[model samples]
Target: MNAPFPIRKECPPGACVCNRQALLSDPQADIRILKLTREEESRLLARLETLSSLADLKKMESRLHEQLGIVLTITPSIHEVRTLRGISIQLQEQPGLCRKTKQAIPAAIRRSLEKSPDIAYAILDAHGLWDGT
Candidate 1:
């Protein structure tokens, strides 16, 4: 039985399992790169530019620095705060489901970034927030 997906093998002791196809497809996956439209890229860039004050930029940088990873930058439905909060609580309880990596942070905090922060930040992005390069 060649399991292509990364499994902890100790989930809840009897957790219902699904997504065999996904595991078979992306077993041992490390990175998840996504392509974006020019407009999307520009919007993300514009948000970065809005970090005018050093304090704001520092906050952004700190958020990014503290990410568990698992990037989800292109999520369009992230503007929903309440939904994100629920997800956050779930994630906090299920820390074993996935490792916190640079990739996961963007996806997990999508709503928070879109609504409260209005700026996309990632711990893997770099040291500066408005590092417009």
Candidate 2:
């Protein structure tokens, strides 16, 4: 069966995080998957910490969608205004998505972080894994 979504080279070998093939093979299945490396996760978390308000987070999310063609939902705590830790991101993907769009997520995030003067160091994570839900 053909892969439902393109598998990125960044993902480690044998890392079948998302059963995209199953989703395509079985029309009833509705599952989309995205795998982020450790470095990507760290950079995303650090960038998130720098934001001052939910509005900023929303803006960033909008930018990601606009520039990278990736849709993500950021869950922030309502109690505290400044949330440095304990953040969850829901990356939205769909079956039969184009390969170019799938590959743009990391590059776009990296470019976004490079603009930050404080975030001078950015490395691609080699040992990142995604646990499919």
> lDDT of all the models against the reference?
0.36, 0.44
Quote model 2's TM-score.
Answer: 0.35
lDDT of 1 by residue, 49-124 (tens): 4554435645655543353222222322323434433223122222222332223334434534445443333322
Error of 2 at 43 (Å): 3.5
Candidate 2: tens digits of C-alpha lDDT, residues 1-133: 3434543233343543444454556855432333333455456556655654445656777865664345775343334323223223456766533344344543444344445422222111111112242
Off by over 4 Å in 2: 1-9, 18-42, 74-89, 94-133
Top candidate by TM-score: 2
Instruction: Give the Cα RMSD of candidate 2.
Output: 12.8
- Model 1 lDDT, full chain set: 0.36
Q: How far is candidate 1 from the true structure (C-alpha RMSD, Å)?
A: 14.0
Badly placed stretches (over 4 Å) of model 1 are: 1-26, 30-38, 63-133
Error of 1 at 78 (Å): 40
